[model samples]
Target: MSLRLFNPRVISRAALPSTSRTFIPSIRRLQDSSSDAPANPKLESIVDQIASLNLVEAADLAQLLKTKLNIQDVAMPAVAAAPAASADAAAEAEEDKPKEKTIFSVKLESIDQTAKAKVIKEVKALNPTMNLVEAKKFVESAPQVLKEGLTKEDAEKLQKALEAAGAKIVLE
Candidate 1:
């Protein structure tokens, strides 16, 4: 079992090469020693000072700089950061987007007999120009549309109001 642990293929102690290899400096070190040297000490100090500032102080400094430089806020154009295939897939997904309902019609399907009076009052309240008798007649009519071509918000509001008054309403 101990002999199995020591493999003959594995060389435990390898002899070093007779000749030493020459050291070659990296391209970055070579470039650093050339014309492209370190940044200006004053600029680096300013950057270090800015980095030390807290969030609010940094924001105030940024605002001051913007005002001093008369810099106007300009929105940057949106760039698609996805790969070509992903961008094509995204465009196809956008093209396959479902149509959203904007305008809706509020229909009064029916009103409970017991809540007829309450429903009538709500209908009259909904339309202030309608008299009580007209509103009552409107409420009596079954499966009649109350309001048409209304926005989603208005339709939802009317639906809630009528439902609360014990009326069956549908928004189409």
Candidate 2:
């Protein structure tokens, strides 16, 4: 057994069957099949054109094509039902989410006598279209609404601006 393990005759290369015949035929078949298939230049050009477009441009092109073709969006029945089921679950989870204040009102309660000029300047800065004289009158009128139906961010910004100018302000 030790001699057999060391002998070259135990596993000879000649004993193996040739795989070149089977392997070469499959490769040749693939080449031949590919050569028989026709190349589409129109499709290739369209694909190349689409690939060159940025994401926004591609989306705009898709929208334009959809509109021009008058194609209505068709969703698969299974796909449509899946989102509806998930949306119900999502709606239930949303109930636990904190609601954010969307709309706000910024009211000017009053202005410090010493900072009246500064408050008027700040108000004018806030509304660039309003002249200095109009801004002075707007500031002099106590307990007046500076801006109404503002977004939360806009209201907070206005509140900070008024407070910095030594004016009493409230956001509702």
Candidate 3:
């Protein structure tokens, strides 16, 4: 060993080799250097006691605290740091759910001239309050909605009745 290794004052920055590693402080050193200290004596005492506990005791203390405070054990990072694949899986799960339509609208697309009277009668049957002239005017106006907000079965039935009367009907 050379005396230069022991004498710190003798070693210049340029004299050191380029491949030499930098000095990294240990975790204990960083912990000791922290300026934050609990202002409350009770909190300070609890911290001191917790610091002195063994690993098993510390874990038991955490569980006890969770129960006493009614704090649920949640992995916050899991939600915020979710992967793209997991998000796609969630979207796929939504897509897998059945989404059949329940409501329907019966629309009168067109009325045939030959069965104009029959179409008018059907319209009158559908709306009892409508008079003959009102029913005729309503029938003459092709591409008009006969009824709205009907169930699938009721709309289908209405469509069949109108179609049988020689009127073009549509269910939406």
Clashes of 2: 0
Model 2 CA deviation exceeding 4 Å by range: 1-100
lDDT of 1 by residue, 1-172 (tens): 3554556446333432333112123544677768757888999999999999999999999899999999987897556675787778888998899879899989999998999999999999988999999998888877888889999998998999899999999988
- The 10-residue segment of model 3 with minimum total lDDT is 19-28
Total backbone collisions for each predicted model? 0, 0, 0
Considering only N, C-alpha and C atoms within 3 Å, which residue pairs clash in candidate 2?
none
Local accuracy of candidate 3 as per-residue lDDT tens digits, 111-154: 88999999999999999999999999988987899999999999
CA deviation > 4 Å runs, candidate 3: 1-90, 96-98
- TM-score order, best first, reads 3, 1, 2
**What is each predicted model's overall lDDT from 0 to 1?**
0.84, 0.86, 0.86
Candidate topping TM-score? 3
Model 3, 71: alpha-carbon shift in Å? 38
List the lowest-lDDT window of 10 residues for candidate 1: 15-24
Ranking by lDDT: 3, 2, 1
